[model samples]
Target: MQNLENGFIIKQVDFKDNDKILTIFTKKGKLSVIAKGAKSGKRANLLDLANYIEFQTIKSKGLDIITTISMRNSFHLSKDKSSLYIFYPLEVISKIDRVDQDESQLFDLLNFTLSNLYKNQDLYISLFNIKTLLYEGLLSDFTNCFVCLKPLEVDIQNISSMMGISHFGCDLREYNVRGYPISIDTVKLLRYIKDLDLKAPHLGFDIKETVLKEILLFSTNLLESSFDIKLLSKNYIL
Candidate 1:
């Protein structure tokens, strides 16, 4: 039997002379599909990464076979900067396993980010990274210290390379954890983002470039340290 679904083309690889292997992130989760005769034609365009697509697939023991596919939304990322925002999330999610268990939350988060990336690039970039960590259960609680287990006020905090977060003044000689210090402003912004509704209209806030860099760096380091995998797209942002 054939199944019909809509998904975003997160990753694609040329298979042979005329086919392509596509990694589509759907509401049901990520699917590996083989698009026969899709390497160079109308179908090839629709199969491009970052494009939202609707398609029918015949399930198999191996990768699903795409029988029919069409573009749903390309998101129109006009600027190079905007394109990286699309790439970062796609790259991160594609590498992490078991994200499909979140139901449609992961799919919706990407949809929301792509749909609204143009409105505020800096805001959406930070939100997308934070939301990814949130959905994956990787973010440390913003209201409390990760090491001390005490209520953390707004202040400079240290994010250890060993995957621990703590107040800057917290001792770490015994734990042997070392990390860079982040400002109180960075803490406030992260707490604010942790509380945001990604589906709702987020009024853009003023952010200094330095603070934005700090947020992105922290997120990248957290994911890398927790998963022990480097995020290549991070090089584009910071």
Candidate 2:
């Protein structure tokens, strides 16, 4: 039976001769399809990473064989920091396991993220990482201390590697992880970003370089640990 789906080509791997195996994240779900003779034919260019496409496939024993593909939108990346900004999120999304409850939201988030990266790389990257964690339900509560369960004081000194806020004198050894001493400003920035709507206008606040670094580090670590996947594109971001 033939099936038609609209989605982005998240990942691709070379197969025998001119064939390729593609991992597609569609509105419906994730699909692994083999494109027979796609490498040297008209279909080769259609399957490039981050290109949104509509494709036809035949499912056989839990695998799919691609029959035809039509490009819907092609995102061009420049040889600069902007390219790294765009590619990292794509790479991260490709590594995500499909969650039935969050697939549509994830798809929209990715589409929105890629669309906005060219306009404001830093804002979108930070927003994307924060939102991805929320969507995946990986973030711990931030309103109070994870251990004490009390409101966080201004002088609180540590952010747990488990993605929780903590106090200065908390027994870090109990958590079996080293904690980063985060400033109150960085914590506030994260909360502010997390509360903003995806379509909200660009953040008007001036984020310090130190705060930005902390956000990226915390989000990256949380995602890697939660998903059990390493992000190779992250190297480019740093």
Candidate 3:
């Protein structure tokens, strides 16, 4: 059997006496595999499924079995309160994208975002990445107007409409083409975060206070209408 390497275990489940049903997100994409006898507290010593992990596996019969599990590195983020910060990305990724899909760039975006969420920096940077990258396209860098190719000025009143984002204009009248009007800073930071590591700088920007807020409102509306983002974040905070 061939071996699969260097993947993170996104999720896991127990079966029968001690088997595990695991959902893994690898660089090769996604998979659901069974690792035999992994449930008991004793056998549980085998793998730690928290943050990011490096792993290798072999296919046996119909399922992939873990050959080895690397060190556990996500302990800081997996704690109770920390996970609340990750809700937005997890919501967007699981909802809009199909399972077993290869979105290497998107996946890297998420990995970086996860690393940054706990850094006492702006969480909106993560949200911005989610917006222009996830729903928008490979060509959509959002730093400039798609039509005029000029830097955008955020007129917050016009920001609520999709026409503001997709077509790219300072005013709603500027576009005969219909599209969403994303925020100026939202576009800038979205482009910024895509390439930069998710190590959020000590930015003075506030998501709720900036035009970015309106952009997120628009992005949220679009995702909800197009995909079931709410359905994925069903695990709510208390």
Candidate 4:
């Protein structure tokens, strides 16, 4: 039987002779496929990382075999300063287990985030992280204090590495947690992103360098703790 799917090439490894192994994140989920004679041909450059592709494959014993491929949307990130942001999400998605799970939402989020990276790299990266957490049901409520259940106003801090947020007077040692202080601006930014409509057009907002750095750090911590996967491409963004 032949299977048809549209996805992004998240990873690729050289195979013997003229073959290459690819990890594609499709609407269904992540799939590992072997593309024969793809190393040196018209298909060589077609199956590149971050390239959205529509392809046909045949299931074999271990991995699927790619029979044909057509390019969809190829994002040019070679010289883009936010190249690291592009790579980190791909690496994270590649590590996700391809079990019998629906990944359509993740696929959409990735596509949207990649498309908007050039517009605001830092914002998009933070958006991607926050969305990923929400999609995975790992994100905590940022609107109120986890301990007091009161509306969070100012001087918020990340209590737990995963998604715990608390006010300044909260006992950190009681929770047996420690994290950096998160400014109210960063908190508001995250809340704004969480409620944003990705498909709509809107004016961009300005963010301070300090706030951006704090948000990035908080996002990295959230991802690492929730997924237990280290993003090797993070160095590019840092």
lDDT of each: 0.75, 0.76, 0.53, 0.79
Q: What does the lDDT read for residue 72 in candidate 1?
A: 82
Instruction: Kindly provide the TM-score of model 3 when superposed on the true structure, using C-alpha atoms.
Output: 0.63
Model 1 ranges with Cα > 4 A deviation: 79-81, 99-102, 154-164, 169-171, 174-177
The segments of candidate 2 whose C-alpha lies over 4 angstroms from its true place after superposition are: 1-3, 60-62, 154-162, 171-173
Query: lDDT, candidate 4, residue 91?
Result: 88
Off by over 4 Å in 4: 1-3, 78-81, 154-162, 169-171, 175-177, 201-203
TM-score of each: 0.88, 0.86, 0.63, 0.89
Q: What ranking emerges by lDDT with the best candidate at the front?
A: 4, 2, 1, 3
Candidate RMSDs in order: 2.5, 2.5, 5.4, 2.4
For residues 1-238, write the lDDT of model 1, one tens digit per residue: 5867899988888888898888988877787888999877677677777899889988777788999887889976776666676787788778888742744888888888888877766677777777778877888777677877676665434433235457655536536655677766777788888878865755566788788887777766777677677778877766
Cα error of candidate 3 at position 8, Å: 2.0
True lDDT of residue 13, candidate 3:
71
Judge candidate 4 at residue 87 and give its lDDT. Answer: 85
> Residue-wise lDDT of candidate 2 within 1-238, one digit each (tens)?
5766789888889988998889888877677899888888777789888889988988767568988789989876677767767678778888887656538877888888887777657666877888888877776556777677777765455554355667755536457566777777777877887777876655766778887787777767767777889988888776
Task: Give the lDDT of residue 191 in candidate 4.
Answer: 77
Clashes in candidate 3: how many?
9
Give one digit per residue, the lDDT tens place, for model 3 in 83-196: 665565554553455655566666566566566667532444335434435534533455445455554454333432452243334434564544654555666655554454
> Candidate 3: which stretches are off by over 4 Å?
42-50, 78-80, 87-102, 120-125, 128-157, 162-217, 227-230, 234-238
